[model samples]
Target chain A: MTAPAPPSVAGARSLVEPVLRDAVARLDPLTARVAGYHLGWSDPYGRPATPGGKALRPALAILSARAAGADVGSCLPAAAAVELVHAFSLLHDDIMDGDRVRRHRPSAWTVFGRSAAMLAGDALLVLAGELLLEQGTRGGVWAARGLAAATQRLIAGQASDLEFEGRPEVSLEECRRMSADKTGSLLACSCSIGAMVAEGPAHLVAALAAFGAQAGLAFQLADDLLGIWGAPEVTGKPVLADLRARKKSLPVVAAITSGTTAGERLAKLLAQPDPLSEPELAEAARLVEEAGGRAWAEAEAEHRLDAAERQLAALDLPRGVREEFGEIIRFIASRDH
Target chain B: MTAPAPPSVAGARSLVEPVLRDAVARLDPLTARVAGYHLGWSDPYGRPATPGGKALRPALAILSARAAGADVGSCLPAAAAVELVHAFSLLHDDIMDGDRVRRHRPSAWTVFGRSAAMLAGDALLVLAGELLLEQGTRGGVWAARGLAAATQRLIAGQASDLEFEGRPEVSLEECRRMSADKTGSLLACSCSIGAMVAEGPAHLVAALAAFGAQAGLAFQLADDLLGIWGAPEVTGKPVLADLRARKKSLPVVAAITSGTTAGERLAKLLAQPDPLSEPELAEAARLVEEAGGRAWAEAEAEHRLDAAERQLAALDLPRGVREEFGEIIRFIASRDH
Candidate 1:
């Protein structure tokens, strides 16, 4: 059984949802409808539906602000901005990746058509900046710069990820760098932008950013593990989804670069032009295990988690705030979906 | 042939090009390459090439600042930011509209692939806000807000344009609003954002914005006319390109809703499934003119230009700045390509 979610996650969601909805409401009607559906605030017909995703990035943003001794109200805009950026990235990435499903539903591009969905994503991105700048403070400008820089890195990482699909071989280092860029940059920004917006000390913001960067890598490693071994119901995707697509995810790259006979055999299986059968997929999974890819990913996640903990330990944050961050770290390491 | 071109246009291009290049160079190599090609600064392979387009938006921005009594250097960032946003929209719009060519060359998506071009557009958008916020002034924050709002409206307008393609009927009012949102919003923002960044008086900013809105509508009207009658050697697009695609451009919509027998014939022709033959396309263009669409568009453009002129006439400005504005207005009204 999974542990209960940290209280900060639920609290952050309640605070950020209204702000996010208000910003989206400012979009044109059709674009707003597309965005509403994508955010899981409603079905395609505009009827209310349960919201999707864990709101983890906004939680991190609010927690960062709290750790900096700022009121929750002061961080709401930053938290919402980060979440909006996350939504924008997912909307565009789904189109590029041709992934038809998101949060167990049809992707926005599939439902609203590619052009409308693309415009909706663009609207959200513009709104994210508008929300931040409307705060009318120096800190708001600083946070906006941080978010923009992170977004550029995120786009670059995605470009590399797509390029990897055409390449026959990818180095483990390149794969790691791609993951850091695609996933870690935004997470690190989310962790520190709220503090920057709160006028927190530079050292504290740096420490929080470092902690988040490590945690984000661990989160990505766990995600790669799930892509190969996750339950379809839990992950909202087919079993061995990454392997089925022959995606150059971290574990697959690690196994291919591992110098063992099993690694070489696994690479050959993936290199074949035809689709892999069920038995072949299972065999490939075994070969990856034999080559120590799974073990390496798991150990790497643990090491990163340890490093994240060290970052917090070096800071003189309030005891309660530190404990809340520790809870989030544990949640990241243990999440199954 | 083009009235020797406006000196302000050349001056603005020279001043803004360096700042624009500096911002784009900050992107990842792949994205930066795509942006360079889209901006006409380089060929697809990154070799230097002659720059394309008139840099009209940046010129309007610089002129706005000058009219507000500020030095051009103080407005450079805002000028570059507006131009970057313009480039960003073109890159994405080319993809959305399935237009394979721009400025006499292959569109960015066609050259770099759609996914890379999309990411490059996304990168330029983020960079636009970054450039503004980096100014570290209250006016910078104001300018960013203005840009963000304009971009949202622009996206919304594009969304409506795409929606119009799927519908059989669209009112002239709907079409006008779409044009205002899609094209007018950005132009108006470009006209005023520079003055805003310079902390110009509220009255001057308002006057510049009004002039830009009227001129922007005039610009779109001219564009619509060119799409039907423009020479391939000049416009870099085939003759009757909009009619070939059955696009519901302002002229086509105006003709269809004109209530003339010719309008009915044009509508029926566009509704047919098969592509229009050359003869049929020419016949359709003739019908649009017979239905008064061409004359209507030309007269409306003149009307808007007159309105734009009155805006400047009411303002107190230096002779040279006013003359430059008048030159651009005349250029807009008389240009054939």
Candidate 2:
């Protein structure tokens, strides 16, 4: 790939802020406060912070469009729309999975309670639809359709995620299937939709979609790796948190299939009711590696990354623009945390 | 006073079924099946049922439009929309309220599990939004606004409802406020949106909204009456289900306020731990009557109907149309079960 364009990180931040700002202003104080808390605009005590999350999904939509030859101004609505969907899912997922901490603070549900959390999530989701309907793009129809489809996939993926509880029979393929639906589907929505809004050539847009899809899979694989092996400081949670929760992440699924002693031990250890001690977490992580799960997951992540690279290479994006998104995809896959 | 027109129950039934049928068909087979079950489309085993919910909401919507002098043909989208919202609320309510039966069968969550139930509800709500968005009427925006507002109220009302458990001091006024948000708001949506789709004059539409709002309050009062004393053969649930559940419905609230012997007994029974037997249920019902709770509730229902009737009388609706809806409101208010 040609030398990377200057990162759209700053451009996207500038572009997306006001859309959200206007949205916040339009809300009544209570819902606005609830929503503000969700955007990490406030602490559990309702105090403001430095703001939060990388705004990755929205950035991807905006960056990909410029990379694919569209103006950033026109893609703002799609960017905001994707961010709302992402936030909505995060809120509900936190509630259902009983995840108490988010961004090193109490999760929205844990603070506001499940009922309010669920309603807040609904409000965000509906806001996405409203954003799409209010879009300036000629493809507002398609934008609405894409956002809705992504929503369905997100829920379906979450359904599978919940189904994976305590069920050791999860196949790697199944994890991949769930990941694609949950993560990759929305990422694909961003890329495909970004290009569509840019009026990027159809074939190029398809390639961008493929790139986003693979990149999303790679991103998730990397996240699973972090969950299992990355340092607690880097990952913002305990090591082997997925194993403790009995989440059927890629590493865990791969380990089960290997049937090594550590793998067998992991399956048995997870069934116990005692809370996972530090040793248990370390032991689980070691078992996954000894069973070749870590290597396998790494290889899978790389393979997806390679596919994303190939799609990018196929696309005739401007050198600077292409390099910017390429760096983003690589960062998503290769970040230590 | 002008004579009320008799509702063509059969005609309304025929008009709404096909609309619901086609709209629900909007989902994929898997999700649609879940939705169909939620709508009383199938047995738990996925087998089809002969028919479904009374389509009462949709019928009211279409009839309200006709009563307001709009072509019924044009209101189909909003009609399907409000019904879907109703169905969405029901699906979620069953899960939250722990109700196991719907329309004489196992609730969708009991049959399909909570996640599927949630998906089904979400699908219906999303489809409702899509239908409203694509409807292309001058009233389309109004329908969307009313629906979004009503749904928010409905959800808030449910939140208030679940909050009432173990709170011994819930007064009659609070119960009325909660029921208005829960039921009255939606009924107002049905008729208001119907008139909106027909582009009826604002004053007349407001009048119809007033009528529907009152009707819904009266309807829910009748429901509270049936909840305690109505027979299972007619009411479709075991008698006194609400009493056993310790539901703080209107009569209980009224009794507490009336401060009679029966009211005192009700207060004591409500504070107890054990299940109320049939005799106990009868005693509680008797106490509510003795304390004038029943009469008060009945009078309240009549007062609402009178308000509804006054609103209808002010509307220059075709005499036949106005009378038909008036009969519906009366039937709703005074139903035996």
On residues B41-119, what C-alpha lDDT tens digit does candidate 1 reach at each position?
Answer: 9998999999977778888999888888889998899999999999999999999989998989999999889899999
Candidate 2 is scored at a TM of 0.80
Q: Candidate 1: list runs displaced more than 4 Å.
A: A1-3, A273-275, B1-4, B333-335
Tens-digit lDDT track for model 2 on A119-156? 66666676776666565444655566667777777677
The model with the greatest lDDT is 1
**Model-by-model lDDT, in order?**
0.89, 0.76
- Over A230-327, each residue of candidate 1 has an lDDT whose tens digit, in order, gives 88776788899889988898888899999999999999999999999999999998988899999999999999989998998998876588788878
Question: Which residue pairs of candidate 2 clash?
Answer: A5-A320, B5-B323
**Clash number by candidate, in order:** 0, 2
Best by DockQ: 1
- Model 1, residue B286: distance off in Å is 1.3
Q: Summarize candidate 2's per-residue lDDT along B95-185 as a digit string, tens digits.
A: 7677887767778888777666776777777778767757655476567656777776776677667677748789888899889988998
Binned by DockQ into CAPRI classes (incorrect, acceptable, medium, high), candidate 1 is: high
